[model samples]
Target: MAAHEMIADDLLAPAASADPHRVLATLREQDPVHWSATHRAWLVTRYDDVAAALGNKALSSDRVRPLLEARKSHDASASDRIRELLSEWMVVTDPPAHTRLRRLAGRAFKQQQISAMGERIERLVDSLLDEFVAGGHTDLIAHVAYPLPATVIAEMLGAPAGDRDRFRHWSDELALVAFGTGGQARPDRHERALRGLEELFDYLRSLVELRRTQPGDDMLSAMMVDDSSGEMLTEDELVGMCALLLFAGHETTTNSIANGVLALLEHPEQLALLRREPETITTAVEELLRFDGPIKVLNRWVVEDFDLRGRSIRSGERVYLVIAAANRDPARFAEPDRPDLSRNPNPHIAFGRGIHACIGAQLARLETRIALAEVVERLPGLRLDDGRPEWKASLASRSLTELTVAHDAAR
Candidate 1:
């Protein structure tokens, strides 16, 4: 709608980043599978199309070339950088290889493993809330949401807990790199971001290598020490996956917690609804994700000619699935706009759908639930000081920049 949101074509689409559903809904009604010359692809807004694209194993997530196309076929070097930085993670990988890497990550975050961390996660949430209690008021993002997920990632990766604070800095900056913050479309800031990422990878490699010899009770250890595989893992793959996990897992959940807090504070009816009916936490989390989803959009390159609802797309064509918009699809959710915490069959694509569904979704749910429950219980009358929340812009990921609030001042 505005000049800046015009960047919504950047994949992250900041213009639509703040309440993008409005724009997406219009697309769903008009073009359903309309092509946005801005994004240089077919923008899939309808729930069915978004679900189809997400489930279409044929549509590849690795879109370095499409990015070049989006850039008006400018520089081959930029194409390489986009492919190189994105190719390592499972998000950017394809088929058989993606399966294996996902399995490896799955082995590390196996349900059994995540289930065991329940108490630890609860304690972590409590400790974070303790700071809010001590400080009277806290910037939920800085003090809690941001740090907790980063800490969980460090633990998962077997990094020292003490480094969690600095890890937050690295993750935040790295996310800016992902979003190309400051409009770093060229080499300058882009190269620096990659360099910083390499440094992070270097640090993770050291730990991964150590786990090769002296193992710990962490995820990196699980991968390195997996006896079932009877094969050693590659360092590049390991670092890539970990870096992705940090960016994907940490930031998304951080945003979820921060955004969820703001939503709950503003919606006292929902806040009391959760407290009086704690069982609603599960459904409430789903609504929170829909109301303020962490991951707003997912992109894909349609490999083969495909039929999206009715619109047609040719091979090698690109498509963008507006998840935030689809979640509010009127056909899918009655009064799609309304944030009904108790909405049943909340079938939302917020965590995405199909093969690339967020691997850390359960972890995100655990983190957000714990954080919100703790905040509500500890901070009385926890409400947003500002009516409007500031959102972050990026190539991927959607979240609040800050969540200032005032409470009962209970120490």
Candidate 2:
């Protein structure tokens, strides 16, 4: 690779965040285990390498511990509350702790329970669509994508419908830290996230207490029970679980719907095919996830020395697994750039792989399936506005800041 290509390969650069596919493609071909000076981490861009790294036991997922340890001399005291809460998040843990949390949280998202919510999800989608269609044009992310899953997850936790906006605000603030967004390292963003987490945790703690006294037929209530293992989550653990579910449950699903819609609008032929053959919605959702999935990158800390593609990674080093790039690797998918809604046997890792795979994968699929079907069928002449859509500059997920589309509302 040339000197300029290396200079342009900064993952944290504004241009790269808007659309990393180009840079990722170059790295995938030239240097599969490229070390990014800007990020000070190893970039794993190949399909096989990223896949193996995700399942690699040597690469630990406890990101919080390392982050706090590095900042211990500076402001670990300031971040104490948030760090404690974040360490409890299942996505940030490894091994026995993650295993226990997964076992307990798994009860809330059983296949039967998720399937039973189909009718309710459909109703929610229709209701949201009805309100947005009143206007000739609207931001799809705000009207549909964000609300559908936000409402579903909130309702599942038995949270009062009225408090949706509050938690949504909290989630948004906390996401600045959870997802690797621009300026995330700044003290203000960290402070805002800390405040948001504090408030949200307090709210969830109270909700858990209520459920403890009078259990209801909801996820929160279900989580409070002791299963075959006879292990129930402690009060703090339950609060942390609720916070993680409420945040993760909606953030990824929101981007999935928005990104899927933009991809379809960009590829008219594929959109028309889906409209003509609605039965392919299931397959379409899978393809959409592959073509332009929401999650872009995931990071892991090396706990033991490992070698890949002739590159040696030492212990305590950071590795970034580029999911978006891996999904489009030519070795894995044919015509990787194009969107083919009917593509089958598509084994995309949009929801990730391994034991830490998204716990709410089924629910996200169900919501996106229903939302896409309704949007395509109801909104005739649905097309992008003249203004170019804005993409969020984040390494954690590929998401739109907003997606405005015009449609034939009269129809």
Candidate 3:
């Protein structure tokens, strides 16, 4: 296909391929701000353009409007419920609303609070590894990557331990809604996504009510009380924030762990480097994030007419910032295609940039750091079961459906 055709086609399908770097690189070079007829959004591929777009105040982050419009065409009731649920998400809002919501939830995710859970995370990692270490072979995603963050996030929210699996199910279904399927035009997928959204919202609401009556030493409890400014979150906003934390909390981290492991296994030298210089675990995690971050694309609507790279972006037009592409942009990083654990000054916007950057970034880094460190330390002989692994067909985020690995049983 021609460059423009490829750019205009369904970007998600090609992105799910084993290697999308070439396609992204081509677009970044040919047309950094090419409009996609397939997705009906402008594709911003270059690192500079993506970084700027992420921080551009002229680009509104209120995605709820478009989503509501899309839902309205098919299901009115579902749209109304979604609007109420998403209206309070800091990520989907702009300016004053986003500012207020971010401030209120930011306290609960403070460094001090997240850091205190380090030992707990470490123990959790150890226990998880203990369960599968003797097996010699297991699906890493199921045994470790998925459970670690899911458990931690559930505990942090004071959710019952028994309900972790159900949370995972809700998260998967909601993911289909948040990140469209390859065939979003299909009505069945839309219906399923809406069902998932409703179920997730109902579950979160019940949890919020429980916290209100019997608060505990958890982030949700912390968020319920007044802050230093004597401000409190409304019920809708509270549930929205909790849902955001619940989904965003585990989903991205789960992908990061799985993707990071895959990257390390593919590059044995880098894996060995990590084993030798364990201190580099920090930088290694950063490199892993840069190499293959979970989030692939983020959408922002143009609030006003703006000229980007000599092209005029009119108001109300959607812009899909290809984060995975930008991370591989040669203009920003040296040897952007290669995964170098020691690569410093890595300014990759994997988590995003500006005021709307990921709030749980520190926590994610902490989780990934601990998880990777434990993997290298405990399973020194670990290796991929097969050279080929399947990638989840997701446009918004990159993830592995499963990752099988084996280590020397004696080890």
Candidate with maximal TM-score: 2
Model 3 global lDDT (CA atoms, 0 to 1): 0.82
What TM-score number comes out for model 3? 0.92
Q: Give every collision pair in model 2.
A: none
lDDT of 3 by residue, 151-224 (tens): 88788888888888887777666665644533345566656767887787788889999999999988888889
Q: Residue 28, candidate 2: how far off, in angstroms? A: 0.6
Q: By the lDDT metric, which is better: model 1 or model 3? A: 3
Candidate 1 Cα outliers beyond 4 Å, as residue runs: 1-15, 64-85, 179-188, 226-232
> For each predicted model, how many residue pairs clash, with residues at least 3 apart or on different chains?
3, 0, 0
RMSD of 3: 2.5
lDDT of each: 0.74, 0.85, 0.82
Considering lDDT, which of the candidate structures 1 and 2 is the better prediction for this target? 2
Off by over 4 Å in 2: 1-7, 71-76, 135-137, 182-187
RMSD of each: 3.8, 1.9, 2.5
- The TM-scores of all predictions, comma-separated, are 0.89, 0.95, 0.92
